[model samples]
Structure formats: C-alpha cells, structure tokens
Target chain A: MLKIEGLTAEIDGKQILKGLDLEVPAGEVHAIMGPNGAGKSTLSYVLSGREGYEITGGSVTFHGKDLLAMEPEERAASGLFLAFQYPVELPGVGNATFLRTALNAIRRQRGEPELDAMQFLKLARSRMKELSMPEDMLKRGVNVGFSGGEKKRNEVLQMALLNPSLAILDETDSGLDIDALKIVSEGVNALRGPGFSALVITHYQRLLNYIVPDRVHVLVNGRIAKSGGKELALELEAHGYAEVAA
Target chain B: MNAMTSNAEAFLRRAEALATPAWVGALRRQGVEALARSGLPNRRVEAYRYTDLTPVARAEFGAAPKALARPELPAQRGRARMVFVDGVLRADLSTLPPRPLSDAAPLLGTVENSATAPVAALNAALAEDGMFLDIPAGENAGLIELVSIVTEGAGPIAFHPRHVVRLGEGASVTILETCEGPDGVGYLHNPVFEVVVAEGATCAHTRIQREGQGAYFLSSIHARIAAGGTYDNFTLNAGAKLARNEIHSALEGPKAACHMNGAQLVGQGQLADTTTFLHHAAPDCASRQTYKSVLTGNGRGVFQGKILVAQVAQRTDGYQMNQALLLSEDAEMDAKPQLEIYADDVKCSHGATIGALDENQLFYLRSRGIPEKAARAMLVQAFLTEAVDGVADETCRAALDEAVMGWWQGVAA
Candidate 1:
C-alpha cells in the first residue's frame, strides 16, 4: 500500500534521510525501530509532505499514485495520515471543530456528502468511546492542555475518524505510559484488516509487543540496515542498538 | 486651510443654521471652535502618533442628509433595538421601554465640553440626534441593541451621535451596539457614548463598527464605575478606510472592576485603531485590557492602552495585553501599552506580541486535510476568540462570533 525507494531528504541544507528504502504491502502492519538520529521521524515527515524538508532525491508512491507530488492536504485527501510525534496545541479551536473541518474537506474531495453538526458529534463520540477517550475532549481546544496519553489518544481518534488506508505513526508511543500504550495499540490493531496498512515508527521494542508487527526493520543512519520478524525487535532490545547497529 | 478641515468647519455652519435650544447651540459652537483649533489629529500629536489621518486630508465630507431606509445588520434576538440613521433616531424602527430622559441639550454640552479628543469635540459641536437610556435601581434591562446605520447618500457627508446611558445603583444592563454605512459613500461617523454605572451596578457594553470601505469612523466611549460596580466593554472594528475607537473607564469607588477588550481586522488600505485608558481611583479596584488585531495586505493596526492607579488606590490589580497577527509581510501593527501607578501597593502587568499566524499550527491543521485557506481562517478566528470570549452576555458573544466567521469568509478571499 505504501512504497519508498532511495528516499534522500534534507532540512535547511542539512541532510537527514539518505537513500532510505522501505515498503508496506496491502493489509500488513510494519514496525520501523531505530535509535535517536536514525531518521525515523524524518522518514515519517517526508512521507506526510511536511514543509521545510527539501527532497534531494526520492520517490514515494501510495496505491500507485505519486505521494510526494501532492500537497499536504491533497495527500490527506488521498487517504494518507500521519500521527505526529508531538501534537500541536490549537488554542480556541475546539477538537470537534478541527475534526469536522478535516472530515468535511476530505469528504468533499471524495465526492461525499458533508456531515452536519449532529452527524459529526454522533460519529465522533462513538469513535472517542472506542478509544476510551472522554467526551469533554471534544469541547476543549485541540490538544491544548491534554496529557501525554490524551494527546496520543487524540491522534488515534483522528486516525480512526479519517479512516485512512495508510497511517504513519511517528514515535507515538515515546511519551505514553503502559495503559495508554495498550489502548493505542488496540486502536491500531483494530484497523489491521484488508486494505489497511501502517508504518509504526518507534525507538523502543516495548510498543511492538502490544501491536505485533508483520515485519520488523531496524533503521540506521537513514537507511534500513536489517529486516526481520518480530523476534528481531527483542534481539535488538536485549543486545542494544550499538551492538546490533555495529 | 485644507479641504478636510474646511469641510468639517462647513458642517458646523450648517448645524448652526438649523439650531434649537441655546444650550445645544453653545455646545456646538464650543466643539466647532475646539476642532478648528486642533484641526485633524496629526502624527506629531502624542495620542495620534501611529495613525496618520493625513491620507484622507484632501477629501471633503459634509454633514449627512436625511436617511431613506433602515440598514439590516446581523443582530441577536430578544434584545431592545434602537435604530439611528445619520445621527437621527428613527422612532419608527426603534423598540424601547418608556423611560423619562433629562434634557439632551445639557447632556450634549456636558460630554462635549469635557471631551478630550478634538474629533469628539467636533462631533459635539455638530451633533444632531442620539440615544438615551436610564435603568433604575436593581432592575435588569437585559440586552439593549443600539444599531446606527448611515444610509446611502448623494455625496460625502458626516454624522455624529451622542449616546448617554445611566444605570442606577444595583442595576444591571447589557448593551449590543452596532454601526454600519453604505458601501460606496465617503462619510465620517464621529460618535460619543457615555455610561454611568452606579454603586453595585453592572454594565456590559459591546460595540461593533463595520463602516463602508469609503468611510471614516472615529468614536469615543467614556464609562464611570461607582463603588462595587462592574463595567465590561468590548469593541470589534472590522471596516472603514480609517477608523479609531477610543475607550476610557474610571473606577471611582472602592472594590470596582472594569474590563476593556477589543478586536480589529484590517485589510488592504484599511486602518483600525483601538486606544483605552483605565483609571483606578479608589482602593482595591481591578482592571484588565485585552486587544487583538489582524492585519493583511499593507493594512495598519494601532493599539494604545494605559492604566493608572491613584495614590490612595492601594492593592490595585491591573493587567493589559495586546496581540496582533499579521497575515501579510507588508502588514504592520503598532502597540503602546502603558502603566502609571502612583500607589506603592499595586500589581500591574502589560504585554504585547506581534507575529504572523504560527506556521506549525497552520501545518497541523492542514495536515489534518483542511485546505490552506480554511485552515488559515480557522486559526485567525481562534486567535480572535480570546477577546470575543470576553463578552459576558452569551447571546451577544454568539452573535459577535458569527460576525467574525462572516468577516473571515469575505476577507480570507
């Protein structure tokens, strides 16, 4: 469902991702484990089409369409979602309002009828319940004062609402506690069916245990150095990144 | 000697020929004299430094003629609406409870004589008709809508409306005031409003100015809060080629509280200014001022606010904040926040921030699939929600919030 070949990108003329290549076929979940400065976040940001990242050379295709050529919102309309590592706090912007705008924009692009206020609230409240999120979060500003777990849960709630085909989780479990990790993992696992895919980026092996991946890849210095099954994550954790990377 | 000055002077001459009581004539004469002395506010003047009225100095605008139709602007329901057209109260289109009023001639002279801004003095001298409301003790007047409309006219004209509101002890009232003008007419709307909040009274006022693109608006508001009284004022300036909204509040009695909040949105050659002064005369009074401005396409926004704590006003707490969001690189914002505390025991703080819409916030919204234009508009509205939320009246706040959306739809394009 997602393809990246020789992805070379830089930020402010400083090279971050150099010739990184990875892929996640349809209906599969893959986990990318890497230590700090391993370009895990860079790869996710590049896939999401965030500005300030200069693509030196690369090609990213989603469902056979060129993803890099699309604008950020266009990519989103094309069913590409990125759960940011650190969610932004939008003061005065209610969480439901933000979600509705996004949902309507995508729905309009897809030639679907727009959801009114009541329809949106009903859909959002159910999804929020599935994620074990409180209803009041919908009334507050977008992640303005949310706790770490709440923020991560909000990201998952958005992912569920957008119902994207490909979601790139960028270090989403770094700040979450154990209970939050299980709920977030369940949220992701629930989306693991036909026509759905994800690239779970994480620094530790703890997250992979909850959302067991179909494949495990270790990224080192902006490139995939090793690819294995779920056991690889345990090996890397027990042996440490220094030993496995060397 | 200039055309603008002469035009203002000619307006007084016209008002003089159509005179009435002696007190009104004398007040008009003093206003004309004061305006002739000062002319239009120049950049050299301390209070008018950032805003330059020189650009419109050549164009001439005379006193407006009789209005033909009433303007229909958005208003919240269940409020008493008082309509005024070209400074003349339209009783045919107004809804007000029966309340006796003092002689307008004397009130006009009093406010005109004590006015500080020369333009206000000009309004007093040439003032024609206005609004008067007196709420007795312990009564809730609910929300009163004072809507002023400048109907389509043949030529450039000016109008001044002197509005006076008095709330007796323990009285409570909420006012939703709006002013609008014709789209293509060049005119001047100089209005003066005064409110007296008696001891233990609560008076909340919301003023909105959406003048025509070819018009100029200059207004002044003076509010006095007595012992244990509370005064809240918010103004939204969204139109006019040039506009200035000046507000002054004096807390005369102990334990009084006052809130001065404003929001301005200017685009292209439009200019909007909000200046406020809060005076704490008695002990243990608190005042807060928050003003927000959004400027784009070479528009200019000016904010000048000052808080004074008198010597005897010990334990005074005053806070002021002014923030601006510039959408275009050429847009400019000038903020001057001052605090003059004569009392030894006081807590005062003021801050100003000038910046573009946060890029990260924009990206966050867009990444969620909101188009760039819609995302930017949402962010701008959120930025302004700070001051709009300051409106204590829920229905009035909802009305203003909808107004912001309506404005964003037009201006964001």
Candidate 2:
C-alpha cells in the first residue's frame, strides 16, 4: 500500500534521509528501529508533508498516487495518517470538535454521508470504551493538560475514528507505562486486517513485545541497514545499537 | 482657533438649533463647552497615549448632518427592543421594558459628569435622545436590546446617545446593545451608558460595535454597584476605521462583583481600543477583566486596564488579562495593564500576551485533514471565545459568536 524509492530529504540545508527506500505491503505491520538522530521522526514528517523540509530527490507513492506533491491535508484525505511524536496542545479546540471536523472532511472527500452529532457521539463513545478512555476526555481541549498516557490514548482514539489505510505511529510508546503500552497495542491490534497497514517507529524492543511486527528494519544513520523478523528486535536489544550499527 | 476646534464649535452650534427640551438644550451647550476645553484628545494625554484621536478631530464633518434613510436592523426574540436612528429614539419601533421605574422621571444627565471623562461629558451634552430602563425589585427582565443604526449619509457627522439602566434591590436584567452603519459614511457615534445595580441586583451588558469602514465610534460606560450586587459586561469592537470603548465600574458597597470582558477583531487600516478601570471602594469585593484581539493587515489594537483597591476595601480580589493575536507582520497590539492596591489584604494581578498563531498547532490541524484556511478561522474563533463566554446569557453569547463568524467571513473576503 506504501512505497518509497531513493527518498532523499533535508531540513535546514542539512540532509536527513539520503536515498532511503522502504515498502509496506497491504495487511502487514512494519517496525522501523533507529538510534538518536537516525531521522526516524523526520521520515514520518516528510511522509506527512510537514513544512520546513526540502525533498531533494526520489519519490513516494501511497495507493499509487504521488504523495510528495500533495499538501498535508490532501495527503490525509488520501488515507495517510501520522501520529505525531509530540501532539500539540490546542488550548481552546475541543477534542470532540476536532475529531468530528477531521472525520467529516475525510468522509466528504470519500463521498460518504456525514454523521450528525448524536451518531458521532455514539461512535466515539464506543471507541473510547474499547481504549478504556472515559468519555469526559472528549469535552476538554485537545490534550490541553492531559497526562502522558492520556495523550497516547487520545492519538489511538483519533486513529480509531479515522480508520486510515496506512497509520504511522511515531514513537507512540515512548512515555507510556507498561499498562498503557499494552492498551495501546490492543487498540492497534483490534484494527489489524487485510485492508489496514501500519509503520510502527520505535527505538526499544519493549514496545515490539506488545505489538509484534511482521518485519523489523534496523536503521543506521539515514538508511536501513538490515531487515528481519521479530527476532531482530530481540537481538538488537541484547546488543546495543553500536554492535549492530557497525 | 484651529480648524478642528472651529469645526467642533460650528457643529455644536448646529446642534443647538435642533428641537430639544430645555434641559437637553442646556446639556448640548455644556457638551460644546467641554469639547472646546479639550479640543479633541491627543497622544499627549496619558489615557490616549497609544491611540491618537487627531484624525477624528481633523475630519471635515458637515455642520448640519441629517439622516438620509432609515437603518436596517435584525429582529431578535425574547428581548424588548429600542431602535435609535441617527441618535434619535424611534418610539414607533421601541418596546419599553416592563415595570420601568424611571419611565415617569427624567433619566438624562442622571450620571454626574467629571473632568476626567471629558468625552462622556461631551456625549451627555449632545445626545439627541436617550433610553431609561428600570427593573423593579426582585424582578428578572429576560433580555433588552438597544439597536443604534446609522444609514448612509452625505458627509461626516456625529451623534451621541445616552442610556440609563437601573435595577432595584434583588432585580436582574440583561441588555444587548448593537451599533452598525453603512460603509464609507464617516459618522462618529459617541454613546454614554450609565448603570446602577442596587443591593442584591444583577446586570449583564453586551455591546457590539460594527460601524462602517469610515465611521468612528467612541463609547463610555459608567457602572456603579451596591452591596451584594453583580455587574457583568462584554464588548466586541469588530468594525469601524477607528473605535474606542472605555468602561469604568466602581464597587460602591461591600461584597459587590464586577466582570469586564471583551474581544476585538480589526482588519486592514482599522484601529480598535478598549480602556477599562475597576474601582474597588468597598471591602470584600471581586473584579475580573479579560480581553482578546485579532489583528490582520495594518490593523492595530490597544488595551489599557487599571484596577484600584481603596484602603477600606479589605480582602479584595482583582484579576486582569489581555491577549492579542497578530495574523500579519504589519498588525500591531499595544497593551498596558496596571494594578493599584491600597489594602495589604487585597489579591490583585494583571497579565498581557501578544503572539502569532502557533505554527505547530497549525501543522497539527492541517495534518488532520483540515484545510489551512479552516484551521486559521477555527483558531481565531477559539481565541475570541475564551473571553466571549463570559457573557452570562446563552442567547446573547450565541449572537456574539455569530458576529465573530461574520467577521471571519469578511476577513476571508
């Protein structure tokens, strides 16, 4: 469902992704493991069409459409979802309102009928129950003063509402406790099917324990050094990044 | 004399020729004298430091400005309305409130004028007609609307409308004042509002100013609250070439509460200002002030607020905050917040913030499938709603919310 070739990108005149190539076929989950400054977050941002990044070379295709040429919102409308590394706090924008707007936008683009307030609330409440998030969280501003766990849960909530074709989880497990990690993994696992694909970006094998990946790609610098199965993550965990990187 | 002073004198002389009662005529004379003394405020005055009124003074308004046509006004339900066209009350279109105590008494010039508020004195002297609303003891007046409209006129003209609102003990009332005019007509609408909240009484005042692009709006509100009374006020300065809203509220009795909140949206070449003063003269009183501004193009906004706690006002709590959002590099915001506490037991604080839209927040919203323009409008509306919600009445709040949306649409256009 997603493909990239020679994806060379830079920020602030310095290259971050140098001719990197990757692919995630339909009905599979792939994990990208990299050390500090390995351009893990940069890859997510570039794929999401965030500003401040200059794409110098190569191309990216999602569902057979050129992703690089589209605006961020257009990319989203085309079923590209990026769970940010740091979800911003919108002090006055309510979570429910934000989610409803996003849902309606995509629904309109896909020619689907929009949901009214009652229908939307019913769907949101059901999803919140599955993720163990209380319904009151929807009334507050988007992640205004949420706890670390609450923020991660909120992201999963958005993912559940959006049901994108491809989901990019950018370190969704960094600050989460073990229980939160399990709950978040369950939320992702519930969405697993032939129609859905996800690229889990993490640095630790701990998260991999909860959401086992079909393919594990070890990234050294800007390029993927190796690709293997779940065992690869265990191997890297035993031996620090230095041994494998070399 | 200079051209501005001479012109002001000429306009005042023309006002004297209007058909007015003896007291009204005398008041117009006093207004002329006050303007003659001040000659229109300049930057030299500390109160007018950030906003210069020289342009308003220099404009060549017609000596005998008349209403060219009837003004268009929307009908709002659940509220008695009083319509004023070119500063003259239209009794044919007005519905006076129920159980009005001041209906038989003369309400004009009831609020004593002072040298400090020269503009208000001028408004009192020149006001063509005024509104007097009285809520009897223990009664609740659902909502009252005062609509002031200025139709398209030939040249620059000025009008003053005085309004007096009084509440008996344990009474409650909500008032919505809307001002609008045709574009390109240079009219100055100067209005003075006098409010008295008796013991255990409550009042909510919401003022919306959306004059013409070439219009000038200057408004003054003087509110005095008695023991166990509450006064809540909100203002939206969303239009006009130049507009200033000055509000002064004094807590005359113990345990009185006052809240002053406002939002301003200024577009190209527009200037809007909100100056407020909260006087805590009695003990155990509380006051709160919050204002927000959104500026684009060459728009400029100013907020000057002060809180004074008298020595006898022990256990006073006062809080003030002003925030500005600048959407363009050319837009500017000037904020000055001050607090004076004569009582050591008082708790008082003031804060101001001026910033552009958060780039991170913008990216987050856009990345969620929301368009850039939609995201911006959402953020601006949210910024203003933080203060707009302070209005107690839900219907009035919704009306203000719609006004903000209308302003956004105009900005987009």
Cα lDDT computed for each candidate against the true fold:
0.84, 0.85
Q: For residues B2-65, could you state the per-residue lDDT of candidate 1 as single tens digits?
A: 4335534455565567665664666667777776666666787788899766554446766456
Question: What does the lDDT read for residue A109 in candidate 1?
Answer: 86
User: What TM-score would candidate 2 get against the native?
Assistant: 0.95
Candidate 1 chain A TM is 0.98
TM-score of each: 0.94, 0.95
Candidate 2 structure quality by residue, lDDT tens digits, B28-105:
666667777666677877889988877766676654245445555687644688887776677766786333323423
- Give model 1's share of reference contacts: 0.83
Best candidate, DockQ: 1
Docking class of 2: medium
